[model samples]
Target: MFFSVVENKSMVNQSGKTGKQLKMTSYLAQEVRLARRHEEILSQRSVLLQQMETYLGDKKTKKTWQTQAADAAHKRNAALLNDIEAAEKKLQERVYLLPHPDTVKLETLYWASVEESLPKWEEFLLGRAETPIGFKKMKSAKWNISYPEEDSQK
Candidate 1:
């Protein structure tokens, strides 16, 4: 469900942004929206199925028309299931077309940034420094605190 967009060599050229980039961006943006839509469709299908089950399981004496209604419900459910399957397949295809991010470079840069900022954070925590500019002071309750157990061997 996590969508990351990295420039694919095939999709980009030396000059500027290409149509493929725009298409990829559009698809990435649509991915979440589409996923939510799929979930809604699934929910609708489930409700329909539950209703059908309830109707068919009723203890009342079966009327001639009840059988026809049940058959129609079954047909509609089958059609919905088919649509869901097709949508899932299409989603998979769209995901397959998405370019994967360069995790190694990303991780390296992330760690470098963290390393650069660690000293400032440590100084602030130690009370020797004021709250760093551009950062708000968070409540103590917002922090997760854990203490290491003392070694019994010691």
Candidate 2:
């Protein structure tokens, strides 16, 4: 979840530690991509196994041909399983290389402090002031604001 928060380029740029933030973002993205690839490989293996099972179960197929097909399918599945294991190991390695969550949180807080020290920082603050208490709770806030271009005719 913290990784997802850091994926925003604006946030990373505002952090004042652009290099480190970008590096972390890149590694997190790579990890997510690898995870998706692992899932895809697993799905492929599942489909292959299912097809092989169906073929082998067909009553019309000759016994000798079925035996040969089964052997080939077994080898294919074994190779796929090996691939899955390799991917799992790589994923684990990536996870191990990531910084501790608490460290990341501290870094994030530091970035927030940096932002808070900048001019006009109050304009970026969330929550409404007119509430029974100090401020009304907000479900979400948008940090990246864009203004429309002014027309030359105006």
Best by lDDT: 1
Give the per-residue lDDT digits (tens) of candidate 1, residues 8-105: 44455566766577676788889989999999999999999999888876734366568878999999999999999999999999878854567657
Per-model TM values vs. the true structure = 0.27, 0.31
Per-residue lDDT of 1-154 in model 2, one digit per residue for the tens? 3555445544546547655567878999999999999999999999999998888777446787789999999999999999999999999998899878999899999999778764343544534323333345665556545556544445
lDDT of each: 0.79, 0.75
Candidate 2 stretches greater than 4 Å from native: 1-61, 111-154
Off by over 4 Å in 1: 1-18, 59-154
RMSD of each: 48.1, 50.7
